[model samples]
Structure formats: C-alpha cells, structure tokens
Target: MNFSQLQCFVALAETGSFTEAAYAVDLTQSAVSHALAALESELGVTLLERNRKGVVAISNAGQKIIPHVRALLASEAAIEQEARAARGLNVGKLRLGSIESIVSPALLAGVLTSFRTAYPDIEVVLFEGAMHEVGEWIEQSIIDIGFVVLPARGVESTLITTDEMNVLVPYGHRLYDRAAVTLDELYEEGFIMEKTQCMFRLMKRFGFELNKDKPSIRYQASDSATILAMVREGLGITLVPRTMLPKKLEGVVALPLDPPQPLKIGLAVKAQQTALRGTTLFVQTALSWAHEHALLQTVSS
Candidate 1:
C-alpha cells in the first residue's frame, strides 16, 4: 500500500531472500517482513511465498503488483527530481549509457565541458558499456539516454549522427593499394571485428557471414586502438567506425569501403515514452553538437 512497503516487496522478489532484500533496500529483515505483511493485508492477497530455501511468486498477485510498484517508484523519483529542478538549480543526476569506444576521453571531456557550462549545478553520470548492455539499460529505464550505433532493432530513437565504417589496414597491405575496397575484395582477408549486434547487422549488409575459421583471423579485439595496433603489427585488418579512430595511430591506413558501409550513430531513449527534463536537454545538446560539427558527414565520403 505504501511506497516503502512496495519497495520492500520488489526488492524481496528480486533478491529471493528476506535478508538479501533487506540489505539491498537498507532495511532490517524483520522490517522488510513487516512491510510485506502490511502490503499483502491491504491488497487482500498474498504476494510471495517464502520458505527455508527462498521466495517465489505463487500467483498473479505478485505480477499484478510489481508493475504498479515500479511505476509508483519511478514517478516518485521523478517528482523529487522535478522539485529539485524547480528551485532554479540543476541538482538531479543524469544517467547516460554509451559504447566504450565512442566515449573516448576527448569526446567525453567535450560533452561534459559543454554540459557543465550550461548547467553548472547538474551532475552527470556516465556509464560505459557494450552496445547490448546499454540497450538493456535504456529498456529498463536505468539510463536516461544512450549514445549507440543503429539500427537498434526494437528501440525508438533520434538519429544523432552517422559515421562511416572504414577498413584500417597496415600501410603495405594488399587492399591499401586500391582506391576503394569492396566487401567481396576483403572476403578472403582476415578481419578483427567488434563482437556485437552491430557486427552481425553490418555483416548482413555486406552479404557475407563472418567465419572465425578463415585462417586469416590473425587477431581479435574490441577496442579500435587495439585493433589498429594489431593492424600496425601486420596482425590483421579491421572495420571500425571512422569517428573511433585516433588521428595518429601510426603505420595504419584508413580507406573507404566501396559503396560505403556506414555505422549509423544515434541517441536512443525509451521508445514511445515521455522523457525526463534532464534527459531531454542532453539529447537535444547531443543532436545539436552532431549537426553543428557535421559529425554525421564522413570526410571520406
């Protein structure tokens, strides 16, 4: 019935134990039990069945109540944030999830600098993660906004920017001599690619399936610098977003992929839902920055 009680119940359901749930919600075990009992008595239904082993949701009671509890908590938090913001002070936290490679020190520093200059009192929290993990964060409302590559299959977002995916190879590599390389041209070459959903979609776009067994997979890595480093050492070649490459990764050459296989970058928010004020501002700033800087337009193209 009460927000505190619902909080306790949700925590208990997630943790599967009274002790663990109490620790998670910062309450004592007896306090958590009391709250759950109060909530069930008010609803006239049992929410959880607990025993020596653990707790389980026995009926539709738990399922029916959870969404309500989650919504209530979210709104309550939003209210608090609104109250703080109404004081003419930017004091609430902003949770932004982004791909690790895209959030390099330079880009992050620039974004933070611009954000702080505008909203000096606002606190920004950055979460660096893989594209898949960041998507989950956005879906769960754990993050207010995210900078990710598209086409994200299920999320609704605005296209903030798009960067071309270029082949970075060693200076003397066979493909480097060509004015532009095609997917078929590199079909037999070794490739170091990011192991993400984007990679799969990109491969699908190229009409080729990635095979690890192709004797040419000389190196495998997730970071662009590492991939380029490996390429510099003649380990193998990689296809990376053009924005991700540092200006001075020595001994490496970036070439256009014929027909241009580009990585569409965008700011993803919770699809079809209202956004928080802070989140809205961040998304707007990001889009403005991308457009003003012509970040989406590739120099090579």
Candidate 2:
C-alpha cells in the first residue's frame, strides 16, 4: 500500500522472520508486523502465513506482488536521483542572452570554461544580440538570464564590471597625442557610430544629444568590428568600450574621454520569474569569475 509497508512486506518475505525483517528495515519487530498488517488490510488479502515456527510461507498474493513492489521502490529511487542531480546543478538547460560584445569567444572565456568544468551536464544556450535586444529577450522570458549594460529596464541584475568609453582615432590623427578629449572637442570630427541603442544612450549621457545637434555621421554600422574598421580607414573617429579593443593597435589609437562616461555591465534576469537552478549556478559562477578577475564593481540595481 505505502512505501514503508511494501518495504516491510518484501523484507519479511525474504527473511521469513519478523525479527530479521525488522533488523533489515531498521524497525522494531512490532512496527514491521503493524506495517504488514496495514498493507494486507488495505489490499484485502493475506500477504504472509504465520506459524509457531515464524512466517514459514508467503501468501500467493505476496508472491504475485513482489515484482511490482520492487519496481515501485526502483521508481522511487530514480525520482530521488533526479531530484538530487537537479539540486546539484548537474542537469538542466540554461538559456543565456548577451550583447554581441560580450559574446565574443575570447571575452568571458574563463568564466564559461570554469562553469562548464563544474557542471558538465548542464546545457548552456547562448543568444547574442545588441543590448536592447538582449534586454527585450530577458523581459519577455525568452531567456533565463542575460549580460547587458546596466540600467536594464524590467529586470533584476548583479553587477559584473564597469568600463569607460574610449575614443578611437586613426593612428595619425591630430588629437592622437591628447591624453583625453571631450564630446565637444570631437563634435565637429567625422563620427563613425555603432548603430545601437546603448551607444546612443552613452552619447546622450556625455552631453551629445544624438537627436538634436547630431555629430557628423560619416559612417554607421551595427557591428563593432565594422565601426572600428571604418575608423581604421580614417573615415571617422568612434567611441567604444576599452575592453572591446584588441591589444595590438596598428591603425587606430584609443584615448580616454576627458570627462569619462562609464559603462556599467551586469547579468540580468526577469524580475518576477523564479530563477532556475542552472541560472542560479551560472550567476554565481559569473560573479565568482568577475571577482577573481577584478572585474567586479558596485552598480545601482
């Protein structure tokens, strides 16, 4: 009838003695007898034959149901195994979103590597897009988690890192020697802009109202590589995250902005959705990675 009753019946049938069955099941002899009695009462059938020599035989019903009871115990064990695996972060699908910049294989490589090493059974799905697109995906429940620039509307976030926007000018540009330049100083220069909402917001934060007195937009593209290439060709200077640039600067020079416009980046998830086990593990792994790499920073929610 119940798991304990089934266990007691099986133990009693196998051992043929109440004392041994109780010892096998870690219950008192009286308790084991009570369980078998309850099981037989629920099924309206005798499960065992008691005698002066003890349970010398099992009833026909007990013989018939032994296999089924074993199967039920096996199923219960499997359920427990699956529950343990889920709690251990050994199984589940993690749907993660991120902007194109952070999705680069080289970026966050250590974090991804460590996470995969710790939880090899967890499947990780990465969706790459612009900041606004990633934010929309998280808000709509299309993904479990995402990495985006701070101030991601409609989601809770944990700060990962902060980087400042830098000016990328051609190698021989006149302002290349300057340690820093302001938005106004580059107002008249040919501006190669990356067509993303985050970039536009950063521009506005730096006092360059893109809608109002727009800079000379000589080139525009959604891809950072394309925008950087345009700058390399001397089409115009551009602004980009310092971390996004390559180590070897051949045709371009990156300079800090005089009044730096800082970009805060963090991992975000839907505010109301209960986070999955995989998602929680991933967030913890990312935060640990950020702390180890000195990328951790405090940011407003």
- Estimate TM-scores for all models: 0.72, 0.66
Q: lDDT at 274 for candidate 2?
A: 54
Cα shift from native, residue 226, model 2 (Å): 3.4
* Candidate 2 Cα outliers beyond 4 Å, as residue runs: 1-89, 102-105, 295-301
Candidate no. 2 TM-score: 0.66
| Candidate that scores best on lDDT | 2
Stretches of model 1 off by over 4 angstroms after superposition: 1-72, 83-87, 102-105, 195-200, 211-218, 271-273, 295-301
Q: How much lDDT does candidate 2 score?
A: 0.76
Per residue, candidate 2 scores C-alpha lDDT tens digits across 8-27 of 98789868999999997899
User: Residue 206 error for model 2, in Å?
Assistant: 3.7
Candidate 2: the clashing residue pairs are none
Query: Judged by TM-score, which candidate is best?
Result: 1
